[model samples]
Target: MTTITKDNITDSLLATVHPNGNSEAAQVIRENGFPTTKHEEYKFTNITKRIESKIQSFQQAKPLGLTQQDVSKAMIKDLDADVVVFNNGQFSAELSSLGEGYAVTNVTNSEAPFSIKDLYDDSYLALNKASFEKGVFIQIPKNKVLDKPVLLLNLVKANDGQLITPKLWIDCAENTEAVFIEQTVSQDEQAYLLNGSVEIKTASNSHIHYYRVQNQNNEALEVNNLLTDIHRDSTFTSFVLSLEGDMIRNNVTLNLLDSGCEGNMYGLYLLGGKTHVDNHTNVDHTKPHSESNELYKGVLADTSRGVFNGKIFVREDAQKTNAFQQNNNILLSDEATINTKPQLEIWADDVKCSHGCTTGQLDEEALFYLQARGIDKKQGKALLLYAFAGDVLEHLKIEAFKEYCIDLVQKKLGTNF
Candidate 1:
């Protein structure tokens, strides 16, 4: 007889399940040390602590709200897009609506390109895959121009210690174009954890603009991954807006697989009170003639903590690659904390790559200048913070969404601009 151990639980949790959530796959991941207790990718973040607390297992045997009509009525007002809604890791077709530009389907009939099994040796990811529940599959056909953005919204409501695992796979075909927006919010204050994954595949000459707005409840725990594969001449861009949540960690990775592939990343996070936000990004150049650029900025107040870890890798054969990454942070309160690491690993001598990171208090002169113009100290501080974050929001393609980000920042920082 074979053994079924906690390691399988770890694999099921990270979401690389086999054709289904296979129990044996979990064992393989555990044996490989990918489920390390001290891996760098999970450094400073406590995963074992969550397990020690006996968090409840996630189940999707029954559906929540899943319907086009339900989604249109419950989601953020004025939001325009084809939407897939997940309530506690299960697809809710009734609570979600589809936008005009794309087609949305439940992944029950299909398989993901990469599963919790393929991409993770990390114990946490394995744990997710072993037990991944419901998922959403988005297909943007070849050469089709999406009429509207596609939105994926997740709501977590629990009676007790439940885990929510939601998976998403987005495929943009050749010469196709689409914009995807993902948002997570909760209707109740529950001590829940959301471990989710989003995988995007962009064909040659196509373009994808993706955004993640994390506005979950302060008591919720969120761990999410956004992974993308870019082919020849394709472009991928990301805008991440994080404001609420007691503990939130987001990992975004982009693989430039062919020549002329381009990746553009911009993000802003504002944390206040005791909230915690961590953003990690990676851009991998596998072929020559590729390019990537990243800029992430953050503002923290009260005793909040913000972390940024960005890595760029250029292979030996990836000559003529151009990659740039920068991280900037502003602290408003004495107890606020910011940790930043920007790294570059280049094997090709002919490639041009540069990375830099900075963290500090708000510009004193800028605040003083605004205050001298009859703005109160509070207002002046908020203005400076807004201006700092607005730079990232500018990358947003939708006018309303950009405005929403600015307004969210202002509200969280305590003075509207």
Candidate 2:
């Protein structure tokens, strides 16, 4: 079944009415159907089913217990940059401290968000825009180098049957260098679902680094949408790691508007105990001399399942374009399953593009080689899995964060290391 969701829903959502400040965006959601896993291109991860098809009413969510005195206490170790915290889709001003160089404000108060007004037309974005009572607007000044990363912390709360949605936007000015991090977590094993979106824009000659971590409650379900627009001579890199949530679906799209731009995307996911995680990526090369690369890997244990779909498109005038994509999966148990696909659509003959995917069980020969040497079967498998993930972990540049992710993967696989 594409979705095993609630067959009978009361549909308590507002009808042609206002929620917070967005009457126009709310009207769009009331007209178009809420995004459900039944929607094509979103079949594998059933987010709607996770929520049992009910829109939740908000109640001042506090996912990250942030306090006014957090500056002197409860600060994330080694994090010395601007930070914004959101609990249950509402922005926290005091818990979120802006850096000296950057300005963080409310979308209603800043022109930073309106700069990307085109996004308001998007059905999902419009839904969030209408319902979101509070959101963050971050602006990076031109010709500035914010050496430290800006962190956005999003926390989710599970109600046996509830639906929550959040919206976040990040913008980088011309000739600027910046990094953005988004982290999410949930409290308990109660069943719930989150639908969210993130938009990023980079001006000419600018550089941006984007990273996301999903650690929702064990019983939570998450559906995330990411959209990025790149201008001439800009560079962008994206990373995603998932270890929590019973089912997770991530949809990411990149648009390259001019020449001399480069984009790179990497993702790592670990699943166990009937968990499901799906990652879909699309790279659009609209002009010449643009390059893009993508690599995604997943490890599934017990009855867990995973899916990966990568698509690259090159317009007729997109000559001298270079694109590459690879998806690999390792199933540590017989019951595990994975669906992988790599696709390329190129109209320019002068372009260089390639794609491939692989799925298989652990190498029997290597497993026995180690088992024969007195290593237990479980330990041997963990060692091989760790080696497989080492390459992806190395691509993570943040030292402490990298180490934490490594430990997280190990813990997911029941390996202490």
Candidate 2 yields a Cα-based lDDT of: 0.73
Maximum-lDDT candidate = 1
lDDT by residue for model 2 over 260-320, one digit each (tens)?
Answer: 9899899998887878898988899989999998989888888888989888999999999
Question: Highest TM-score among the candidates is held by which one?
Answer: 1
TM-score of 1: 0.88
Error of 2 at 14 (Å): 4.9
lDDT of 1 by residue, 1-417 (tens): 112245554444434343466455466565754323376766755544544344445433234544455455556566666667776677776666656556677765234455422233444444455556556777788889987777777766755425667878888889998888888767678666677778889999998999989888777777778888889999999888888887787888898999999999898888888887888788989999999999999888889888898989999989999999999988888999988889999999998899998888888898888888899888788777777777788788877677677667778776422
In order of appearance, the predictions have TM-scores of: 0.88, 0.87
Off by over 4 Å in 1: 1-19, 22-25, 32-37, 50-62, 65-74, 99-102, 113-120, 415-417
